[model samples]
Target: MTAVLSRGRSDAPVRSVPGRPAPRRRPTVAPTWFLLPALVVYALVVLYPSLAGSVLAFTDRSGFDPGEWVGLANFEKLLRDDAARAALTNTVAVAVVITVVQTTLGLLLALALNSAIRARNLMRTLFFAPMMLSPIIVGLLWQYIYTPGGPLDSTLEGLGLGFLTRSWLGSDGALWAIVASIIWHHVGIVMAIYLAGLQSIPPELTEAAQVDGAGAVRRFWYVTRPLLGQSTTIVIALTLTASFKLFDQMFVMTGGGPGVSTQTLSLVMYQQAFVYGEYGYGTAIALVLTMIVAAVVFVQLSITRRGEHQV
Candidate 1:
């Protein structure tokens, strides 16, 4: 009887307690398999072309011929190329300026608007309106504004500042003009990101800082900015990458002219591949650009992550 009772107890079904449900096993494999179709499409559309282009970087294909492989020759030429070097310098300058200015201004705008104020919503919308416009449209608009006798010059002249006006898109100032337009066009997005981060921060933090006799600046330095590390990381990474690859607005506004003063790596790559039929060289430039962006972003993220951990 004792052996039979022990056997019966061992074979008894487990039951959930009253008012509770049994735990269900999650189908992890099934959920992962569901991602296969999208992954397949991404591989075909993005990865394949990228890999093919990278391979072509070693060959002398000119879009018309099955050209021979000339490993590292194009890269060697790139090292000696003056225009490529100049474009690289300009690209770095533009990226750094845009990243620094955009991030700072965005944070300022977010802080200003985060406070209770009249028509804050409307002001936010107005500030972000430029981000909604296409790059081409913004380019055209700024192009018109920067035209010698267009609104900008006319306004300056009308304000007795005619001496301040010059060839906005034709002189040394052309690069700066392009940089300014890009900043205006994309700063709104930066503002929006910072604003979201600001909103997500708890009000209790600020109030506690105030109770501890912290002033506005101190509160921001200690309470707000630290909490915004993730947002800053995201914003800086995005602006840095986008600024490096900037092509459309610059193309439309200056065509990298009066010379190569405003030319960036992307513009150079485009001109080489499609305009000059140097496909191999173009791909090589593209590969260099990809590597630079990846390396910079990786370093930036690592630094930001380390800072977050320290905080």
Candidate 2:
């Protein structure tokens, strides 16, 4: 009986020793070969085309014949081109204005809807509904709204504010009109980002701040704002990039028009490449735009990441 009991005890699994951690199983890793198919497709589609197009930037190709290499001629011409310079200026201005105004308005809207209020859910849905619509649709809708004697002007005239009504898409205000429409279309996305950030924050933190004699403004400034650093970074990066590459809506509404008043870099590139068949010049412009976007985004990420760490 003693020998049988001892053998059974010896066969039992050993328990972990007190105060010692049990050994952890190594996680199973997928083989790198699993990514080979995707890598092959990406190289064929994206990498090959990008590399080929970039090479064309140095040549004087006109979409038909394989033209000779122009070295830095295209870039030099771009520097001296008045239209290109004006487009660059307008693009930068529009991007900055949209980023600032949209971000501010989105934050405000997020704050308002985040609070416990009647119809907040319905209001959020309504505001975000525009985002679901295609940009072309939004452009067409706003185009009609901005037309003289259209709904906007009619409403203003009915309200006895007829003096305020003018050609919204006129040269004097066409750029701004496009900017407003872009903001209205995209601000809801920014609001959604902020709302997600707000929800992630611990309610205890804000409650404690309130109990410690912090007013609404102070609490938001010190506690709530700092916690939203990540969301703000994401929102700004997205808005900045999107604004820089603005093409579709602007193309639909103004066609870079009222005499280039709202011409963006994208519009210029499109016109040069598709309309005029200046393939090489258009490719150069695209390369420059890509570099600008990459550099700006890098600096922005650095600054925002530093802010996050400080928070």
Candidate 3:
């Protein structure tokens, strides 16, 4: 009996059962099903519209009047048109100015807010509040401020600086006014993003730098800026995209006025396609705008990606 018991114990498995592997569970099909709704919606909403728009852009469709294929005639006209050329120039100028100015201001704001202060949270909220307003609403609000006898003019007059007041909504001043408003409105958003990035960084690194006799400027230049590579990339991309799509501010504040001085590609597209009756031409301009934005953004992304790897 003792020998039989010893043999049984010896033959036992070290772990659990030789009872057989759990029935190979069939692979779940949920992943495929999970993606089905979004794919279906995208096909209907985005893919179809994009394809149809591309096709429409090839023809000379004057509003509801459909015409035969004009090949690249619309694009040829777009290049030749002076209005389009001016709009393109204005758009580029606004984008470049806003990106640079807004980015610098945002970084400084972020750095300021990251420090300890009594009203830091309040200031953050106040700064961010403007960004939360709708662009159209903001534009409308600024129009009142920009119009003659508005608060801005009143303030100038009150300060005995009335000579500085100009027709902000008219002439080239309109463009500058819009740019200033945009910077003021959106700088907070960029600051918030950078603040988040700053918070994610380890405090010990900056503390260590301080111990090593690094001053504020030098420490930020050497340590903080390099580590903020991702944040900077995000700010640039967002500002670039926003500036390229500029419409609401120009539309409400100046109506692209002082005779097209503030006209942008997006505003031109809207006017051509809907206001006037040149759908095909508008589509061509739209295509060009899309290509320019995509190309520039792609180049920027590539450069940033390379820099990220180096960092």
Cα error, residue 126 of model 3, in Å, equals 0.1
> 1-311, model 3: which lDDT tens digit per residue?
11211224534433423454433334568789999999999999999998889876889999679977999999999989998999999999999999999999999999999999779999999999999999988998888998898899999999999999998888677898999999988999999999988998889989999999999999998889888888888899889988998999998888789898999999999999999989999999998998999887888777875554222
- For residue 218, what is the lDDT in candidate 3? 93
- A best-first ranking of the candidates according to their TM-score comes to 1, 2, 3
| Every model's TM-score | 0.90, 0.89, 0.88
lDDT of each: 0.90, 0.90, 0.88
- Model 1 global lDDT (CA atoms, 0 to 1): 0.90
Say which prediction, candidate 1 or candidate 2, comes out ahead on TM-score: 1
- Scored by TM-score, the top model is 1
User: What residue runs in model 2 are displaced by over 4 Å at the alpha carbon?
Assistant: 1-31, 309-311
Give per-residue lDDT, candidate 2, residue 186. 97
For model 3, the superposed segments whose C-alpha errors exceed 4 Å read 1-33, 309-311
User: Can you write out model 2's per-residue Cα lDDT over 1-311, one digit (the tens) per residue?
Assistant: 11211223434444445566653444436667798899999999999999888998899999797899999999998999899999999989998999899999999999999999999999999989899999999999999999999999999999999999988988678999989999999999999999998888889989999999999999999998988899989999999999889999889998988888988899899999999999999999999998998888889988987766233
Q: Kindly list the per-residue Cα lDDT of model 1 for residues 86-190, writing each as its tens digit.
A: 999999999999999999999999999989998999989998999999999999999999999999999999999999999999999899998899888888889
